[model samples]
Target: MKNDRRPAGHVVAIASGGLDSTTLAYWLKADGAAQLTLLGVDYGQRHSVELSYLEATAKTLDATYIRLDLSGAAALLAGSALTDARVPVPPGHYTDVSMRATVVANRNPLLLDLAVAHAVSTGADAVAFGAHAGDHTIYPDCRPVFVEAYRRMITVANEGFIAAGFQVLAPFIAMTKAEIVRLGTLLDVPFANTWSCYQGGRRHCGRCGTCTERKEAFALAKVFDPTGYETDGG
Candidate 1:
């Protein structure tokens, strides 16, 4: 009898070089259970710093890093801060509806489609993302409901050709950014290697929505945050 249940397949991880995604990559590595392929999508966001950061992270983790260019999609969706040259990336919490300017239309869905394609082509059994609770508040696609729905979509979307099947694993969906930071620290994730500033500046703006939340997470976690921020208190 062939051992079909072996855990020896590639696992594609959607890495954006942010706190959550980077932490997810490290968590998978800590488990030491399967091959990992890191996917970093370039959707023409002002911040390319995170892409470079992910390359460094992949090097450190010794995982294969794939940079997929979806800048065309960003060009098409120009109203959001992430793609538009006019709107500024709102400097507030993820819950602030105004901050929705950063969300590209169906952005997560697009990236997940590419990731799922790669998984099917490579015979991987799973695809992972870093959609934590904070994102669920703002991004419609990052919520648990979307994740589950997408899981079923992909499964049916990639039927018998991919005999093994796939699952959308979100290990941090229920946790706040603070709790994620705390847990990631415990996993020895190199937070310093990650970048969260959406301003595309030389250093973290420290005032943007992502920066504020990142600061708040570390503050709440009581961990020494290595992010380059000018402010001292949240």
Candidate 2:
């Protein structure tokens, strides 16, 4: 029996350089799991710095990396704290209501469509993303239902253009951040190389919603975090 059940083919992954996406990159490339491409979309988020991490991960994994500048879209989606300087990045857990300030309108669908386009052009069999269970409550786009509907929509829209047996994978869909952290640890992923701050500080702000979630994920996973934080999170 084959040890890994993952299909063998070219795959394009939507990479954000955060822990979840970084770990997904590692998982996708390890042991020659697939022909991997890391696609980063910068929609003028406060932390464009995260793309730098993705660049480094691509180098380490020898995976092709492409960054699309979608900053123009941010002008219209500027109400989100990620895209607008006027809005403050909420500090707290992801489940907090205020964290909705981080949601960029139509963010996932736009990104996913771009990935699907690239996959069709390149004949890649899959387009994968990192949308863990913890994100389900925070972002409707990250929910399993959205993923399923997206797959169906693309299958119908692309019809015969996409690769045979094309797939949309969200491998961590059922997992919480802590669960992903554990899997990353087992995969020997260098967690420190990943970024999770909504702020583009030299180090993690340690108070933003994503930073708080990152801190909690490591603690819950019993993994030693190597990230530097500007504050003690007090």
| Candidate 1 overall lDDT versus native | 0.82
Worst 10-residue lDDT window for candidate 1 reads 1-10
Q: Which tens-of-lDDT digit does each residue in 1-234 have in candidate 1?
A: 021122446778888998899998888787663788999988888897789999988998889999988777667888988778899888766666776777778878888888889988888877888888878766899888898788789878788856464567777888888998988988999998899988887778898888988989999999998987755453
Off by over 4 Å in 2: 1-6
- In the predicted model 1, the residue pairs found to clash are 81-101
Whole-model Cα lDDT of every candidate shown, in order:
0.82, 0.88
* True-vs-predicted CA distance for residue 123, candidate 2, Å: 0.4
lDDT of 1 at 168: 72
* Runs in model 1 lying further than 4 Å from the true structure: 1-8, 230-234
Candidate 2 similarity to native, TM-score: 0.94
Count of backbone collisions within predicted model 1: 1
Task: Output the number of the lDDT-best candidate.
Answer: 2
Question: Could you tell me how far off, in angstroms, the CA of residue 223 lies in candidate 1 after the best superposition?
Answer: 0.8
Q: What is every candidate's alpha-carbon RMSD to the true fold? A: 3.9, 2.7
lDDT for each residue of candidate 2 in 1-234, tens digit (9 for 90 to 100): 021234688889999999999999988887355689999999989899999999999999989999999888879897899999999999877655787898888888999999999999998988888988887777899998898899899999999898777888888888989999999999899999999999888899998888999999999999999999988663
